[model samples]
Target chain A: MSALLELSSVTRRFGGLRAVSDVTLSVPQGEVLGLIGPNGAGKTTLVNVITGVHPASAGKVRFAGEDITRVRPYQAARRGIARTFQIVQPFPGMTVLENVAAAAMFAGGLSYGQRARDEALQHLRFVGLAEVANSNAAALTLAMRKRLEFAKGLAMRPKLLLLDEVNAGLNAAEVDQALELIRAIAARGVTVLIIEHLMKVVLSLCSRIAVLHHGELIAAGAPQAIIEDPRVIQAYLGKRYARAQAGAHG
Target chain B: MKRDASIALVLFALVALLPLSGEAYWMRLGTTMLMYGVLAMSWNFIGGMAGYPSFAVAAFFGLGAYAGAVAQKFGVPMGFAWVGAGLLALVFAALLGVALLRLRGHYFAIASLVVAEVLRELVNSMTGLTGGGMGLNLPIPAMASVDAQARFFFYVMLLLAAVTFTAMLITANSKLGFGLRCIQQNESAADMLGVDTTFYKVSAFMLSGVFVGVAGAVYASWVYYIEPPDVFDVLYSVKAIVMVLLGGAGSMFGPLVGAAAFLSLEELVWRNYLEVHTGVLGLMIVLLVLFLPKGLISLSQRLGRRGKLR
Candidate 1:
């Protein structure tokens, strides 16, 4: 399958600091790609570069064969790139259904009113948030807010969905439910690039894994091979831990 | 939306009967009230709906008053001049919003607040066109009598206020309004949801300016004279904001209710406490905002709830 998203030598700098440097990666159509890195590995910055929240300081980004290197955030969304913030961002004054319906109408190319609301309801059901559809989004609990993010992302009818630490604050059972929802989303042929710290989720749900260390792509391959890679282990668990793992495996 | 529209229609119909009283004093008060309603309703578009604290109302108002005055000076028809003022305000706001809306919150407020001062200076310097700080004079309309002129201007202001109210009702129910509410609540999320934030902000700003500009032109025509400090006074901006806050920000009837309440207070205070009216009015507004931050709409709703309990 052809790559749905291609980043060539993407670099993002905040003044003098290169937050994301020389990172080149791609996700093929319908692939569930896990992006794992240690803290300050620039994972979120890389996603920002992709979504044009912070346009790459250098390099090109191609989405579905079209160059979208300098598109605005709204344009990126309308072009079928949907993202959830690392910290959930909901329109607090709006109802949960209104939030998703806004996504459907604006980015999903559906008309506002009944059609958007109906589509939003379907996404809400998929995320198991149908019960609180009419409640103010601010009233939702953290887990529910995370699920609201998923419903919002789905309502955008995205070709590429970037889940930014959706499981970060979630508990074990909530994580399992999220994992199931993600698998269902992937089954529907949507490409996902999920940033996660959870090794279990990375190992089980992702067909392919990419590692970033100090703003560079350290490794990319099948999840099993990636977990055992010396550099990936070193980057995540330090050089001493990598040696310990190597000794145990040897 | 339907209920609000019908209520507004009946209210306007009753207000339209003011001329039947045959009292010039009442006519003057009613006209001034309607004009205030226009200013307040216009401010609601950007300040209340879009969550942008704009202090550029005086800039648009002064620009419109001058645009109409200057156009009339050059022999343009009265109706065409008012329309020209509205269009000029729309264009000016569109350009201004692109630059000003980039700044959010306090920064945006301060930036917009300077616009009126800058415009006042510009009008002050342009001696030949604007007659400088000496003030400009508008030609008296060729009406049969002074009473006829007063009645005509009163009806004109009434019409402008009604149009502004209708526009607000339409906007509050439209996709544009929904996007604005989203922008107000969470701008970044709205942007990621494919709302063109800049576009929406500029549209709201334009909506806030167009009607106020027309009303300004009407005021200039009604008064027959306008000076830079008189038309471009920063008080216009402050009063618009106060009126919205008084009634209820972002509510359908808030601006109108606030305008009526505010004007009545102004008239009453000015009558009884002419020496200290400004000080008293300022203190009263501070108290109103402090005690009823949600505005009179919430208070009425609270009262209605209590009645239901009874």
Candidate 2:
């Protein structure tokens, strides 16, 4: 399949620091690409660059063959790139249905009426949040809020959905449910680039995993190959563990 | 939504009967009440809906007053001049919003606060056009009797308030309103959700300015004079914010309720404590904020909940 999103040597800088630098990556159509990194390795920054929250200071971003390097956040949404914040961002006073309805109405291009509500309800139901659809989003538990984010992302009608540490702060069972939801979303053919710290979740869900170390792409391959890569291992587990693994392998 | 619209219509009709009471003092009070209603509701579009604490109401109001007064000096009919003033404020707000709205929260408020001062200076400098702070006079609307003139201006303000109310109702139910609510809640999230936050904010700012602009124009015409200090008084902006806060910021009836309550309090305090009315008004606002932080609408809502519980 053709690449749905292509980044060529993308770099984002803040003052004297480079948060994301010289990362060339392509997410092919319908692939759930895992973006794994250590703390401050710029996983979230890369996502921000893709979504035009912080447009790349250098290089290009192409979505579906159109260069969107300089598009604003709203334009990026309209162009079908939706992202879930690592910390779930919901309109606190708004009901869950209204929160999702905003996504359907704006990014999904649905009219602001019963149709938008109906669409929001469907996504809520899909995420098992239909029961709390009328409750204020701020009142939701963390697990429910994560599910709400999924519903919102889905309501955006995104061709490429970026999930930022979606499984963070969830228990094992909650992570499994979230994993199942991601699997179902992938089954529906939406390409996903998920930032994850959970190696198990990344290994099980991603067709290909890319590793970031200090704002650079260190490895990009199948999950199994990525796990065995010394560089990837070093990036995550430190040089000591990587050296031990190399010694054992030899 | 239909019920709210109808209730608003009924309330407006009841207010329209003020001139029939035959009390000139009450009629004048009613006119001022309606003008306050227009300002409060206009502020609600940005301050209440979009959650932008804009203190630029005086800027728009003063601009409109001047625009209308100047147009009248050049022989423009009063009705068209009022509309021209509204359009001018709308365009000014759109342009201002693009730049001013880039700052959020306290920064945005501070930025908006300076706009009226800037406009005041500009008007003061344009001595040839604005009469160099000497103030400008409008043609006295021709009528057979003084009572007829009072009724006419009162009705005009009442109509302007009604139009503003209708616009608020329409906005409250529109996509623009929903987007604005989203922006108010989480602006960055709203942006990611494709709400076109900048456009929504600018639109809200324009909505907040337009009716106030027209009201200012009407006020100028009603009073037959306009001066920088009188028209560009920062108190107008403060009063609009206070009224919206007093009413319940986002609800449809909140601003109107707040305006009525505030005007009544102002009138009562002025009559009884003429020497220290401003102090009394400040104390009352403090008490209201302490007790009814959500405004008067929440009082009804709380009571309804209590009644259901019983």
Candidate 3:
């Protein structure tokens, strides 16, 4: 399949420091690409540039073959690009149903109230949050809040979804559940670019993995190959991987 | 259908009986209450729903009063003067919103307050049109007797209040209302969900200004006097904020309850204390904010729960 999103030579800066520098990445249609890195790898900065939350100092972003470098966040959303924040910002005062319904009505083009409600309910059910639909978003547990975040992005019906650390604070079982959900999301023909630190989730869900370190990509390949790459081992896996590699090489 | 019928019935009952009841003083007081209820409700549109506390109400209200006074000076009909004032206020609202809405949260509030002060000073300096600090006086309508004019103005104010209140109620449940609420909750998230935050904010600001302007027009006509200090009082804006806060900032019925409670307190305090009435009003606001940060309506709602945690 053709690439769904292409970031060519993207760079972002905050005063003197460059957050993301000359980064080029691509996610093909209906593919789950994992972006793994140690802290401060510019993974979240890349997401910000892609979603137009922050303008890139230098780069071109093409979505579905159209140059969308200067598009605003809302315009990018309308063009089938939606994202969740690492912090999981939901409308605190609104009911979970109202939160998703707002996304459905505004971004999904559901004019009728009943249709919006139905679509919102469908999204809630998809995220396993249907039972708590009437509850205030502020009342949700962290895992539920993450799910609501996903449901909110899903309500926009975007073709390209950016998931930012959706499994950060979950327990082991919750992590597995989230992994299943992420896989299901990709299985629905939606392309996903996930920024995560958990190797288990990345290894299990991603078709291809990209390792970033100190604002640069160290490796990009199939999951098994990326885990075994020399640079990836040096930058992330460290001494144990070095010893294993030495034993194999010798 | 049933709810609509009940609402219509309540409105009809209020309209048919309120003017006929009791003494002239009560009637005048009732008119004042409605006028303030209108102002409070209008403020809630921007401050409560859109989560932007604007302090430039005096600017819009003063502009409307001045517009009416100018129109009346040019021999415009009384009804046309009100319309002209509303349009002028709408224009002022759009201009002021463009400049002030760019400042978020507390900065927006302070910018609006500064703008109102600037407007007050400018109006005071303009000797030719606004009559400077001494203020302007309009000619009395020779066609109507004093009592007839008072009753007419009361009904006009009542009608304007009803229109404004109903419009707020309708819009609060509409798509625009949802968008405003979303903008308040999370501006960036709302933007990502396809809400035009700037447009919604400006529209709310303009809508609030239109009602406030209408109130000012009626106020000018009722008193048959227009003074810079009276029309441009910063207290008017404070009263709007106090009423909305007391009533329930975001609730539909909050402004009405707030206005009633506030005006009644003012009347009682003025009758009893006279000298320290303003201080008493200030104290009441402080106490209310201390006890119930969410407002009187929410306080009552919580009271029924018998201290159950929210």
Candidate 4:
């Protein structure tokens, strides 16, 4: 499969410290790519750079064979790239359905009232939120809010979706449900780049996984192989500690 | 069953009967109430819907008044002068909105105030066109006797208020209004959802300014005078904002209710304790902000819920 998104030597600097340094990765079309990292490993920053929230200090981002390095967030969204924040953001005063409909009106040319409502309902149903269509988003539980965030992203009808910590704060059952939803979305031929902290979710969903430590990608491969690799293990611990833990555990 | 028609019917009844119940002084007060209602509703377009607090209404209102004054000075007909003032206000608002709507929250509010102050100072410094600090006086047109003038002004203000309120209702039900609400609730989320936030914000600001400017023009004509201090008074902007907040910032009838309540209080205070009216008005606003931040509309909503349970 062709690469849907390619990031080469992408670097983001906050003053003297680099948030994401010398990172290179590619996501294949119709595939789920998991990005796992420790806290402050630049996962969210990478997503921000790709979505044009923060300009990459040094790198090129090619999405579906087009250079979108300098595109604004709204422009990138219009170009079929959609993203959800790690902290789920919803229009608090609006009903869940109206929140989705606003996206449909902007992403598609569904300017008419009935058309926007219909398309919004379809997206909400797809995300299993059709039942709470009239409920104010402010009243939704955290899990439902995460689902609504997903629904909002889907409403944009993006060719590529970037999800940041969609499973954070979710119970095990909720996480399993989210994982299933991600799998289903990928099965529909939408390219997904997911940043997650749960190792089980990353292992189960990603066809390939990239490991980041201190703003650098230390390893990338099949999930099992990457998990067993020495460099990846060493990156997670100091070299001596890795040897000690491996010896003791083995 | 639509809320718009129900509200419209109530407004129509009130407008039709208000002329019959009062002396000339009370009718004059009625005209003032309608003017404030128009200004409040206009402020609602940007402040309530778009979640952008604009404090430059005095600038647009003053601009409209000045336009009318200039037209009248050039021997233009009274009717043409009013139209010219409104159009001029619209143009000025569009230009100003483009520049200031880019700012968010406190920045936008302060920018609007600065614009008003700048306009006031510029008008005060210009002696040739505006007659400078001395102000301009117009020869009262012979359209009506003194009593007739009061009645005509009341009706004119009523008609303008009706048009503005109707426009707001239509906007609240439209795509533009939905976009604005989204922007207000979560601007970045709205962008991800495909809303052009800047466009909607600027459009709302301009629409709000046009209505306010038209109200100022009518006010100047009704009072038969125009001056920099009176036309560009910062208190008018505060009154509009207070009216919107006291009624309910984001609801259709909130501003109207707020205006009525505010005007009644002002009248009582002026009549009973004229010397301390300003201090009392300030105290009332401070109290309202602290205790009823959601405004009278929310209070009524809570009451209706309790009534249902009982």
Best by DockQ: 2
Which candidate would rank higher by lDDT, 1 or 3?
1
List, for all models, the DockQ compared with the true complex: 0.83, 0.92, 0.72, 0.66
List the lowest-lDDT window of 10 residues for candidate 2 chain A.
A237-246
Question: How far does residue B185 in candidate 2 sit from its true spot (Å)?
Answer: 0.4
Clashing pairs in 1: none
Give stretches of model 1 more than 4 Å off. A238-250, B307-310
Better of 1 and 3 by DockQ: 1
Clashing pairs in 4: none
Candidate 2, residues B1-310: lDDT per residue as tens digits? 8999899989999999889999889889999999999999999999999999999999999999999999999999999999999999999999999999999999999999999999898888898998868989899999998899899989999999989999999999999999999989989999999988888999999999999899889999999988898988999999999999999998999999999999999999999999999999999999997899999989999998988954
Tell the DockQ for candidate 2. 0.92
In the range A46-126, model 2's lDDT, one tens digit per residue, is 999999999999999999999999999999999899999999999999999999999999999998799999999999999
Model 3 C-alpha lDDT per residue in residues B13-96, reported as the tens digit of each score: 585466676467977898898888888988998998999998877877888888888788889997899888998888888888
- Please give the CA lDDT of all the candidate structures: 0.94, 0.93, 0.85, 0.85
| Poorly placed runs, candidate 4 (over 4 Å) | A237-250
Model 1 chain B weakest lDDT span, ten residues long: B301-310
Q: Give one digit per residue, the lDDT tens place, for model 1 in A50-169.
A: 998999999999999999999999999999999998899999989999999999988998865798999999999999999999999999999999999999999999999999999999
In model 1, what is the error at residue B178, expressed in angstroms?
0.6
Tens-place lDDT per residue, model 1, B41-75, is: 99999999999999999999999999999999999
What is the clash count of model 2? 0
